[model samples]
Structures are given as C-alpha cells and as structure tokens.
Target: MTSKKLQVIATDKAPAAIGPYSQAIKVGDLLFTSGQIPLDASGQLVEGGIEEQTHQVFRNLQAVLEEAGVTLNNVVKATVFMKDMNQFAIVNGIYSSYFGDHKPARSAVEVARLPKDVLVEIELIASTVVE
Candidate 1:
C-alpha cells in the first residue's frame, strides 16, 4: 500500500502552534487541526473574558479550515476544552454563531489548565473537498 504525503496548512488569522506542529494536517481526505487557544493572528492571546476569547478561537479555526480547502460547514466533529465548564453557555452561544446552519458533533469538557492559561480552546475534525 502506498501512503500519501502529509500536508500542512498555515494561516495568519490564527495563533501559530507554539510547539512543533502545524496549524492543520491533511491526510488524504481528512483534515485535522490542532487545538486553538484564544490567541489572535499576531500570536498574542486576545485580552478579554471567555466571550471574546471564544470568538477569537472561532476566527482562528475558520482561517485554518479555509486554508485546508474546507469550511465550518464541512466540520464533522469538534472538541471544546474549557478551564471552567460554567462558561459553556457563553462559548456555545459564540460557537453557534459561527456555524449557524451546520451542527457538528461536539464534546466540551473542563480542563484544569490550558496552554498560556487561555480561557478556552477548540479543535476540529473536518472533511476536505473530496477530489
């Protein structure tokens, strides 16, 4: 069996990965994006509460998705990590605004800590445009 080459997608709208990782990975027809914190395109965490941070996270995800030839509509699943589950309502409200039409399977959980101590982080699994 032949293996396909790994494709890396990078975007300026999202905070770049702090470690040795690409913003998103393309393997065949699937695109896997790394967890996105509330950092802006300039790689600085947005100064705000959970609400503003959530919005910035979505924007970052959007940039990565578009870079990989996909949109939020193509997302099949999402994993949302939060330092406090109590902020679910606020984050959900913002998340819903991004994908008003498509509803992807998602799981949200409270983590003890996140990189850079951001209030929220989101990662996604999406399907690429099938060639």
Candidate 2:
C-alpha cells in the first residue's frame, strides 16, 4: 500500500478560514483549495459590488496558491460560486484578466447563498509538480 502525505496550505495574506477547514490542502502533486469569499485578511468582507468582490476573491486565492508554491498558471481546475448568474459576464471578464493566457478547466455556477453572503467565492485545484 502507498500513501500520499497531506500538507495544509495557508498564508497571512488571505483571510483565515472561518470554519473547521484549511485554506488549501496539498496531497502529492495536487493542491486543492477551499472556497475563498470576499473577505480580507482581517476577516472583514470587502465593500463593493460583484466586481470588487470578485477581485478580492481572486486575491485570496492567489495568496493560498502562493503558499502552496504554485501560481494561477498552475491551476488545473477552478470552481466559482456566484450569488447571481446575471453577473456571470462581468465576473468572467475579471476572471479572464487574472488568468490571462493560461486557460484552465473551470466551472462557475450560481448559488442561493454563500459565506458572509458575499457576491462570489472561488476555489481551485493546482498542480504542485514543477515541470
């Protein structure tokens, strides 16, 4: 039998997990992140509409990714949870800017509610293998 060690990934740059969950977890060469809301490092939700909130979510994701020694470019899959599907276009634009040329597999869906009732939340899966 073989086992892959689990490494909890965290960073002060992002908001601390509010519940019994880690910011991210790395098992073997894969890093799986928790859903990040639009909360700052101090745990205060950012003030703004979908645009600002979405940006904050990305910032939080970036911090967690960095802690795992990976970048957005290394992300293999992303799951976005939005409060409203109507804002998909706007959110997609912001998402595009962050991802730039690296297009990873993504899934975005509208949910009834989210943590802190934030406009958007994002989670990602990244490859830690430095190839």
Candidate 3:
C-alpha cells in the first residue's frame, strides 16, 4: 500500500497560524484549511461589521488556498461559524458574492464565540487543482 504525503502550506499574505496548527494541510490533491477569522496578517482583528469581517475572512481563506496551489473556485466544501444566527442573510450575501456561480457544499452554524470576538469564521476543503 502506498502512503499519502501530508504537506503544510503557509503564506505571509494570510495571518499566520496562531496556535498549534498549519494554515492548511495538503494531502495528495486535497487541501484542508483551518478556520479563518477576520484577523489581518499582523494578527490584529479587522475592525468592522459583519460585511467587512466577511471580506477579511475570505481574504485570509484565499491566501491560504493560493499557498496550497488552489483558488476559492477549487473549494468543494465549506463550513461557516458565526457568533449569531440572526446575521445569516448578511453573511450569505457576502459569501455568494465571493463565490459567484461556484456553489460549494456548505454548513453554517451559530457558535458561542469565535477567536478575537469576530463576527464570522470560515473554513474550507478544496482540490489543489481546478477541475
């Protein structure tokens, strides 16, 4: 049996992993990203409302995906965690704007809290190459 190789992907464009984790891990052709909050590259949380925070989260996600040799278009699945469920529609709008026509499988849930008290966090699983 052939064993798969796990590769850690890191980039200076995105906020560095704050804890004990890689920004993303690539196994074979798949890339799994850690949950991205609204933190900037300096580890400072972006100051703004939901829409702005969403943008920061996507920016971070894009950075990590790029480091893994992929783009948001390659995402096959996504998970969103929010501090409040009442903001679902707003978050959905921003998310749709980012993804455009590429609809990936997703799940969004309201969590008790998130790192840095941000309004939203996002994570993704994607292919290393666009199909």
lDDT top scorer: 2
Indicate whether candidate 1 or candidate 3 has the larger lDDT.
Answer: 3
How many steric clashes between backbone atoms does each model show?
A: 0, 0, 0
Clashing pairs in 1: none
lDDT of 2 by residue, 25-118 (tens): 9999999999999999999999989999999999999999988888999999999999999999999999999999999999999999998788
Q: After superposition, how far is residue 16 of candidate 1 from its true place, in Å?
A: 1.7
Kindly list the per-residue Cα lDDT of model 1 for residues 1-131, writing each as its tens digit.
98988999998877778999999999888899999998888888888899999988999999999888889999999999999999999999999999998899999999999999999999999989743
Off by over 4 Å in 2: none
Worst 10 contiguous positions by lDDT, candidate 2? 114-123
Pairs clashing in candidate 3? none
After superposition, candidate 1 runs with Cα above 4 Å error: none
Model 3: CA > 4 A from native: none
Put down candidate 3 lDDT per residue, 1-131, tens digits, no spaces. 88999999999999998899999999988999999999998889888899999999999999999887788899999999999999999999999999999999999999998987889999999988666
The lDDT per prediction is: 0.91, 0.94, 0.93
Give all TM-scores, in the order shown: 0.94, 0.97, 0.97
RMSD of candidates 1 onward, in order? 1.4, 0.8, 0.8
